[model samples]
Target: MELEGDLFSLTNLRNMEIIDINTGAKLGFIKDLKINCEEHKIISIILPSQTFKISLFGKNEDIEIPWDNVKKIGVDVILVDGKNLVEE
Candidate 1:
């Protein structure tokens, strides 16, 4: 469920950057989303996988930021506390 009076458009969300507060890293942009249709809640935000030479041999996996990890949503960035839970 959406927080009371808290609403955001997917297009705007996609336009904002995701920044990690702990490491001050620009993890990446929001690539996609995982949502819970039955519950009407967002599960997580997806980010493109980190670049690696290993991808030449295997498929790259994208990163996910749980909804609970999101700390703030600003005009240009989404502040997150993913920390070590997310790699730079």
Candidate 2:
């Protein structure tokens, strides 16, 4: 089966950089996603870990950005509220 929407595949989104709409700072690249299995919806986006060693060890302190914070989804970057959404 296939899916369709204004948003493209998750593959396309993985490499896309996440940016803060308020600060205009590049947060990081999306590394994974948190899903609500019951609803079959994306709950949040997980950003790459800060430390390389931790990421290498497969213990990522991934920054999670709630889907509600997403303001815009562009071709190259996803705009979100850094002030509140980004879980540091």
Q: Which predicted model would earn the best lDDT? A: 1
1-88, model 1: which lDDT tens digit per residue? 2232267899989998988889888988999989999999998998887665345557567788888898888877898887646532
TM-score of each: 0.80, 0.76
Instruction: Write one digit per residue (lDDT tens) for candidate 2, span 1-88.
Output: 1123375788988878888889888888988899999999989998865555454556756688888888888777788886765444
User: Cα miss at 24, model 2 (Å)?
Assistant: 0.8
lDDT of 2: 0.77
Task: Please list the residue runs of candidate 2 whose C-alpha ends up more than 4 Å from where it truly belongs after superposition.
Answer: 1-5, 51-58, 85-88
Deviation in Å, model 1, residue 46 alpha carbon: 0.5
